[model samples]
Target: MDQAETKEWSRRYAGKRLLRSEILLDDPLFQQLINTSYFTPVPSIVRNYFQTQCQRCGNQKRSLFGSIPCYSCGNVHVYCRKCIDMGRVMTCTPLYEWTGPEMDWPHHSNACTWSGELTEPQRKGADCIVQAIQHREKELLVWAVCGAGKTEMLIPGITEALRHGQRICLATPRADVVQELLPRLQQAFAKLEIQALYGGSRDREATAQFIIATTHQMMRFKHAFDTVIIDEVDAFPYTNDPSLPFAARRAIKPEGTTIYLTATPRQQHQMQIASKKLPHVFVPLRFHGHPLPVPEYRMCYTMKKDLATYRPPKAFLKWYHRRKHPERQLLLFVPSIRLAEGLSEQLSDILHDCVIQAVHASDKGREQKVQQFRNREFDLLVTTTILERGVTFPAVDVAVLAANHTVFDEAALVQIAGRAGRSPNDPEGEVLFFHDGKTEAMGAAVRSIKRMNKRGGFR
Candidate 1:
C-alpha cells in the first residue's frame, strides 16, 4: 500500500466493516485495500446462518429474516429487515472488514488512572463484574435500584478490565444516557480515551480503549469488545424492540462476556437468573441508603376524555393548585407525545410563574429543553415516558397524568416513581399516579415500592 493511501485508510476505516454498495466515492481505494492484505470480504447474506438465526442480530425467527425482492440486484435476497435501518444487506451485497494492523485490539492503550471508591453494596456488585469478565462468564445481571450508585459500581470492574488489557464497551438504550455516561466515565478513567457513539455523534475519530455507545450503534460493530456492559437493560428502544440485545451480543468477542444493569426488569429477567442463564447480584438499597419513594394514587375518572376539551378534571386541578408550589420543580409524565404538548399548554395557562415545556422523541429541541429545565430555567416539564428513565432533578416531584393507560406497565410504573426523590438533598418527594381506575400494574408498582422499603426498613 502507498504511504498516503495506507494512512488515509487506517485513519478512516480501520475498525469498520463497510458494505461495498454503501461506499460510492472511495471505490478504487477500497478495492486497492482488498487487493492488498488490509481489507477482507465477508458474505453479506448467509443461508440459515446461525442455525436459521440472522448472523448479524441473532434473530432466529423465520419471518423476520425472510426473503425480499431485491430490485437493486435483480433477484430475490434474504435480507434482515430487523437491522435494515443500519444499511441494506442482500444476497449480492458484500461486506468488508479491515484486516490491517490498525484495527488490532490493543491498537489503543489500556492504561487508566481512576481512583474512585464504591459503596459496600456497590463494591460487591463491582467485584462480581470483575469475576464475570475475568472468567469470561456469559451473563451477569446487576439489579440495583435507580439511584443505587450503579454507575460507580462499574468502576472497579472497569479498572480490572483495563488492567488485564481488555477492551470494554458500555452500551445503553438511550442517547441521553450515552451523553451522560461518557463524561463521567471519561472523568473517572482519566488516562484512557472513551468514545461516545450515538445518532449524529461527532466522536468517530478516536480509537478509544473504552467505548460508551447506544445499543443502536452496536449494530455497526462486529466482535469488538472484550467486555460489553449494557446499562439500563430494560429501558426504551431496547425494550420496544427485541433486536437490541442481539446487537449487544453480536458486538462482543467470542470469548467475551455481558453485564446487564437495570433498576426495573421484566419477569423474563428473573427467569434468566433462576434458569442459570445469567448470574445475578441484587442491591435493593441506593447509595444514600434511603427508601425508594412510594407513589400516591389519586383517581380522576374523567381525565382521558377531559383533555380533549382542554379542561383538566376538577379533582386534579384542585390537587395541583394546592400541592404545587413555586419553590419545587415538577415532572408530569403523559402517555403520548400529543398529550404531553396539550397538557403543557393547559398547565401553562392554569399555573402562575411556571414556565413549562414538553419533550419527546420527535421534539427537535429536546436536549435544549432538558438543559433549560435542569438549570432551573423552567418550573416544570411535561413529557412522554421518554423522560421516564434517565432524567434527574433535585427535589423534583413526579405525577403520572393518566396512570391507568396500558403503557403504564409494572416496570414502567416503577421507573416513573423512581424519577422522584433521586437527589439526596431531597431524599423524599411526591410520586402521584393519577388514574381513572386502578389496574393490576398500578397496584403491583405500589406494592413493589413498599416491599423494597420494608426490606430497607425505611418507614
Candidate 2:
C-alpha cells in the first residue's frame, strides 16, 4: 500500500492494536540509517514535546506522539495515538493493551456438573466466597470442614475470572494435590488453557490462561496474575512461612484479589477474622452428597516401646483384615518415613497377595507410587501426611498409626479422614486413629469435625 493508504489504514485501526513485527536493533541497513539520521536536529517543538525513558532499556530520548525511529537501535517505538490525537506528548510510555479485554479471549467451557447437593452452610459459605471474588475483595478465608468441597466451590470464581479475561492460579502445598486437581479442573474448564505447574511437570513455565501450581512455585511469579486462589491455605508452606504469604501477595496485580480456601484456618488468621480484620466464610459440609464420617479413635496402648519392632498391634491388624476387600484399597498413615517403611515391610509378609507400599516426601518414585495407589494396584499404601489433602482414593479405609503424633494436628487429621469417603459410591468409610494415648488435640479434631457435620445435618 502507498504511504497515504498505510496512514489511512493505521488511523482506522488506531486504538492500541497489537503489532506483530520484529524490531531490528542491529541490522546493518537500519544501523547505517540511524547513524546518519541521529545528528539530524529533532524539531524544537518535537524535542521539547515530551521525553520518555524506555522501561527495559532506560534510554532517555525525545518522544513523539507516533511511532518514531529509535536513534540508537532503529526499532520502531509505537505510541498511543490518543496523545498525538490530542496534540500532546508525555514523558511516560503510553500503556496499551496488546490484547483486548480478557473476556474476549476464548476460555475453556468445562464446569462442575456434579449433581451433588451442598448442605445449607456449605452453600452459604461457597456463595460468600464467590461473592467476595466477584467484588474484587483483597482477602477472604473459606473456613470449611474436612470433607467440604473447597476446591469445587472455587469453580465459579475461576470461571468468572476466565470469562472476564482475568488470569487465575490455584496453588496448593503438595504435588500430589496438584496432580489430583489437574484432571478435575481439566474436566471443568475443558475449553480454557489449563496448565499444572510443579517441579516435574513438563510445562512448568507454560503461559497458560489458567494455572494450578504448588506453593513453592509462587516465588517464580512476580505480579503475573489477576486472581490468586490458595487451596489448602492453612496447609504447610503457606501457613508456616511468612515469605510464601508475601510471595502470594506479590504474584498478583496491585488491584488483584486473593482467595484462601481451607477447612482449618490458622489461629492467627482465625484471630484476624474474629477481630473483623480479615473477611471470612465458612462451609461446614462435604460435597460428596453425604455427611462426613465421624472418625472412631481407639487407644491401642501396647507396652511395646517400638510399635514397628513388635507384631503390628493386634487390634489394628484385625481392623485392617476385616475392612480389606479384594477390590478396595486401604491407606495406612504412619508418623514418619522410617515407621512407614518398617510397617510396610512387616505388613507385606502377613497378607497374601497384598502389596504394601510406602511413600514419603523424599521418596524418589513418589509419583509412580501414587499412580499405582490410584490405579488400585496395591492392596495397602503407607504414607505420611503427604497424601493428606490432595489425593482421593475411592473405596479406601484409612488408619492413622500413632495418631497422637504432634504432626497429626487438627487440620492434618481432618484432611487424612477426608481421603476415606470422597467418592459417592464409597460415601462412608472407616477412619481409625490407632493412638497409644488420647491427646487433647485429637479430641479437638474429632469435636471440630463432629460439630461441622452436626451443623450440616450429617448426624
lDDT of 1: 0.78
Query: How would you encode candidate 2's per-residue C-alpha lDDT over 174-258 as one tens digit per residue?
Result: 7878877898888776656689888788864346768898876665455567788888788887776555676677678778888
Per-residue lDDT over 351-430 for candidate 1, one digit per residue giving the tens place of the 0 to 100 score: 77778898998999999998898899988898888887877877788888889989888888998898888877778778
Cα lDDT for residue 76, candidate 2: 67
Off by over 4 Å in 2: 1-126, 204-206, 303-310, 321-328
**TM-score, every prediction:** 0.86, 0.71
Q: How much RMSD separates candidate 1 from the native structure?
A: 3.8
lDDT of all predictions: 0.78, 0.68
Q: Which candidate wins on lDDT?
A: 1
Error of 2 at 451 (Å): 1.3
Model 1 is weakest, by summed lDDT over 10 consecutive residues, at: 103-112
